[model samples]
Target: MRIIGGKNALDASSVHPEAYPVVEKILQATTSTLAELMGNNSKIHSLNAKDFVDEQFGLPTVNDIFKEFRKTGA
Candidate 1:
């Protein structure tokens, strides 16, 4: 799902729009679709939060993203 009038496609998710790039990076690293990641705690757990860290999104943000994935549902 996407935000009705939002610029960032990730706005519909628990993840913030400003963190879109972080989500993109996570997807690329995991080679998984958004659908595949959502609500998949095991898969999300497999990921290393540190690996996804960057200047914009630090370890806490990445960990938050992982938390979002664990709880987000369709």
Candidate 2:
């Protein structure tokens, strides 16, 4: 992964390719649930991204992810 920020501006890190599927699944599930909840609704003009993510995805933390990984022996 590449990260760009601050004075240093850029940095790269490595991640296992196997992790991609897990991340993709999380994103797909989040977006699908969000769409279902927002179906036929046009009044959401001021929803905060953070709040929306939290509400829709339950704001999963590192510990939660780790717990899931352990549960699945991943």
Best by TM-score: 1
Question: Highest lDDT among the candidates is held by which one?
Answer: 1
Give the worst 10-residue stretch by lDDT in candidate 1: 1-10
Quote each prediction's TM-score: 0.81, 0.26
lDDT of each: 0.80, 0.33
lDDT of 2 by residue, 23-66 (tens): 34543545633223232223222222344234234434322432
Q: Kindly list the per-residue Cα lDDT of model 1 for residues 6-69, writing each as its tens digit.
A: 6644666667778878888889988998878988888998888999887778898888888888
RMSD of each: 2.9, 13.9
Look at candidate 2 and give me any clashing residue pairs: none
Tell me how many clashing residue pairs each candidate has. Answer: 0, 0
The residue ranges of model 2 lying beyond 4 angstroms of the native Cα positions read: 1-14, 32-74
